[model samples]
Structure formats: C-alpha cells, structure tokens
Target: MTGWIESDRWAERARELRDEGWMLMDLCGLDRSGLGRSVVNAGGAGTAGAGFRNAEGTGGLYGPRFEVVVQLLHALKKERMTLHVNAAGDPPTVPSVVEVWPTANFLEREAFDMFGIQFEGHPHLTRILMPDDWEGHPLRKDYGVGKVPVEFISQPLMQIDSPGQSPETVAAERSVDELGQSGPPLRTVEEG
Candidate 1:
C-alpha cells in the first residue's frame, strides 16, 4: 500500500515504521513540476494522471514541486509499504533516512544526483552518478531533452587483380556504400 505524508513528518513517520519492523528498501525523488501534462494524449485528450488535487480534494496545481518516494519491507513478514513525502521551496529538501538505514546513503545520494533533492543530515551528500561539474539535474521534468547524433564511416571493397581467380577469392568482400562497388585495389603477385 501507499500513503502520502507531509514533509515535516517524514523522519518521524519513518522512524515509527522502522520500529514496526519495516526496513527501508529504496528512496527516490520525483519532479511533479508539469504533472498537468496529458498522460493519454499530448494534445490533452484525457485526464488520467494530470492535475494536482489538494488534501480537501480541490483541483489545482498548487501541489509541491517535488516529492520523495520510499519503499519499505518487513524482513520476516514479507510485506511491503510505499511512503511518499513532499519537498517544497525553491530548492526542495527532505530529512535523510540514513540514520534509520545505512543503505539509504547511496539511495539518497542517487536521488540528489538525478533530481537535485537535498537530503538533510546526510553525512556526505554528493553526486553519485553524474560528474561533480554537471550543470543541472537530468531526471527533472524541467530539464531540456538533449540528444547527440551518430555518424557511420563508409569503407570501400578490396579488389583482387589476379586473373583466373574468382571474385570470391577474397572471402566475402563488399563495399560499405554499395555491394560490388570499386574500392582500394589489392594487387596479387600472380598478376606480375
């Protein structure tokens, strides 16, 4: 099951669950900046995952810009729980659960690397995936989608100048541009 909790009560609730035999499995960040985007169609055909609703069920985009999602597991009982905590302000932040689970060190670092969600009280919070000089959080929805183009090198076919020797003497020779195209001439001793 999943439950959304306030940001201020995040560490408090996490501690409660830990005492109840819950172990932190993973923690990640979310960018809900443009949740209003149409999930069904880009042109806004239907409303499924878009639009923000307040605690009172009123509709608006006034929700927090970022959120932290955590997965918890009960070791012996074999049960799971999902917890969500909001992170607000110009630079969103949440209390680190590293104290509760040492494994959260890497998870919270990854969240910070990808989404720029600060984990307060973390021993050494730094970029875990991206380089230290990286410009912005790549996983955020507001980040621009950049792409690099690839180019292919064309190779010409080799030729066997020896007469009486079949064209297949070179064992599957072909040109990169087109089959049987002229390429670098390979002179044979038999021709001399």
Candidate 2:
C-alpha cells in the first residue's frame, strides 16, 4: 500500500517505515503542473497506481501538485509499500532521506536534476544528468523545450556539395594540391 504524508513529516514517516523493516527501494519526484486532463477516466482507476489510488477515486495518487515518492521493500515480509510526500513550495522542497537510506543520495540528485525540486538537509544536491551550467529543469511540465542551433563547417575531404561532381573538381574547388594540402587553384571542370 502507498501512504501519503505531509512534507514536514516526510523524514519522520520514513524513519517509521525503516523501523518497520522496510528498506528504501526507490526515490523520485513528480511534476503534475499541466496535466490538462484528470487522472481518473472511464478506464476505471485513472492514472493513480495501486498505492496512490484514493478510496474516493480522485484525480491523482498524491497531492494535486508536486510530490516526492518513495518505494520501500520488506524482504522478510515479501511486501512493498509506496510513500508519497507533498512537496508544496514555489520550487518544491522536500526533506532529504539520505540519512535514512544512503542510496537516496544518487536517486534524489537525479530527481532534483530533472525536476528542479530541492531536497532540504541534503549533503549535496546537484545536477546528475545535465551540466552544472544548464539553464532549466528538463522534466518540469512548465519547462520550455529550448533548441540549440548547430552550424557545420565543411572540410575538403568531407565537403557535402560535391554530390554530382568528381573528387578532382571538389579538390580543385577546395584548392587542395597533389599532396592534399591547400595550394594554387587547379583547373575547374569546365576549364578542363
């Protein structure tokens, strides 16, 4: 089963789960900013997973906005539990669980990198996929899909404009000499 907890009580709930012999399985964040449609549908239970589904069949598995989700496994009991924490903030801040499960370090970093959610009390919260200088969080629904324009420089051997022309014409146009070095211009195809 999945239980929803407030952001302030996140760490405490995690500790409780740990005391119950639940090992942290996974940790991540969710962005529900612009999900134009409701999570529930005629398909029965909507997008809510087994754990997030409310008894009232509401919209989501967690809060209406951002959420930090954790999966726990009970090896001896052969069972799993999902925990949800509502990250309510402009930038969405949640408590760090690294102290509870050291494995959360990398997983939380990845969540922050992709979603721009902040983990309070984290030893180091930084980008894991994008460069440090990257501008925006890529996974956020409101994040723009920025495009980088690329320019290609052509070399004599790699020139693409000589599709129908002979290599000799290409070499001449590029002023490449017999030694494949730039030298005096050679006769053009028409000149020859």
Candidate 3:
C-alpha cells in the first residue's frame, strides 16, 4: 500500500502510524525535479493512474523538487505501507521522525548526506556517508559528477593454491609466449 502525505503533516502522520503498531522499516530521500515534466508530457505512458496532486490541489504531477519516502511495516499483521512526503523548500526540509522512531536517526542522516534533505529537530544531523567537508550532495540530480580514473589489477588465470594446481603445472600447460598472446595487453596510464 502507498499513500502521499503533505510535508507539513509528515511528523504528525508518522507518530500516528507508530501508535498504530507500525514500525519504521526504512526512510530515504529522492530528487524528483524534472520528473513531473517528463511524466506529464509523456501522456498516459508514465502515469500510474493513481492521480497524484499537491497539498493545494494544484494538480501538479510531481509536486516538489525533493521527496522523503517512509516505509512502515506492521510486523504482527505482516503488512507494509509506504508514505511519500514532498519537501517543498529550496533546501528541502522535513520534520524528523526520530522522536517517533529512534531507528530513523541514521537513516535521516544518510538522506541528508546524500540528497541534502534537512531533517528539522534532529538531535545531530550530520553527514553519515560522506566527509564532513564534502561540498554538494552526491545523490542530488543537479549535483556535478566528478570523473575519477579507475585502475584495474591483473590476476593470474589459474589459482596456484588449488589442489593439484601449482605455478609449475600452469607453466607446463601454457608457455609464457602462449599466455602473452592469449591474454589482453596491459597498458600504462600514459597509453590510456
């Protein structure tokens, strides 16, 4: 089951769910900046037929730039439900659910670290995955992507430690000249 809740009523709704024997299974943030345009322009292709509207009933498809998704589980009942809350400010801010569910502490912090979603009233909302000095949210759609070179390490074809297998056995089966021709050529950084 899934439901959309207004950002202003997020914390209140979360408390109600908790009192109703629901456990916070997971919480995450999402960037839905341009999704409304894409989905609306795509006509019925991307529409889920569930007709989503903002708090003001403006008929906006996606509502906001950021969203906070909360998954709740009724363990004894073996049921699950998801709540989506749109964060509507510049630096998307949402009320913290840690007061209702202590387990949401780190999860909210992670959302803050990755998507720049601020959890208001959090005890200590700091970056959990990235360095404290990290500039922008890494998972944000508009965040600049940095290009880093990746190095691959070459490994031997056969395991020398395996039973009935040794360096000598491998050498006898395939000579160095044959191995060089069969294996891919190793290239230096300059070559790349």
Task: List the global CA lDDT of all models.
Answer: 0.73, 0.74, 0.76
Q: Which stretches of candidate 3 lie over 4 Å from their true place?
A: 38-62, 147-192
Instruction: Report the backbone clash tally of model 3.
Output: 0
lDDT of 3 by residue, 58-125 (tens): 35534677888887889998887777788888789999999999999999999999999999999999
What would the TM-score be for candidate 2 when compared with the true structure?
Answer: 0.65
What stretches of model 1 exceed 4 Å from their correct place? 37-55, 58-62, 147-192
Error of 1 at 65 (Å): 1.2
Give the number of the best model, judged by lDDT.
3
Cα-based lDDT at residue 120, candidate 3? 93
Instruction: Write one digit per residue (lDDT tens) for candidate 1, span 1-192.
Output: 555677778888888988999998888887876765311112121224344344354233235778888888887887777666778776788989899889999999999999999889999999999999888899998786753233464445456767776777653553333333455446468863
Using all chains and alpha carbons, the TM-scores for the candidates as numbered come to 0.64, 0.65, 0.65
Relative to the true structure, candidate 1 reaches a TM of 0.64
Error of 2 at 148 (Å): 4.2
Alpha-carbon lDDT of model 3: 0.76
- Residue-level lDDT for 94 in candidate 3: 94
lDDT of 3 at 10: 89
Candidate with more favorable, higher TM-score: 1 or 3: 3
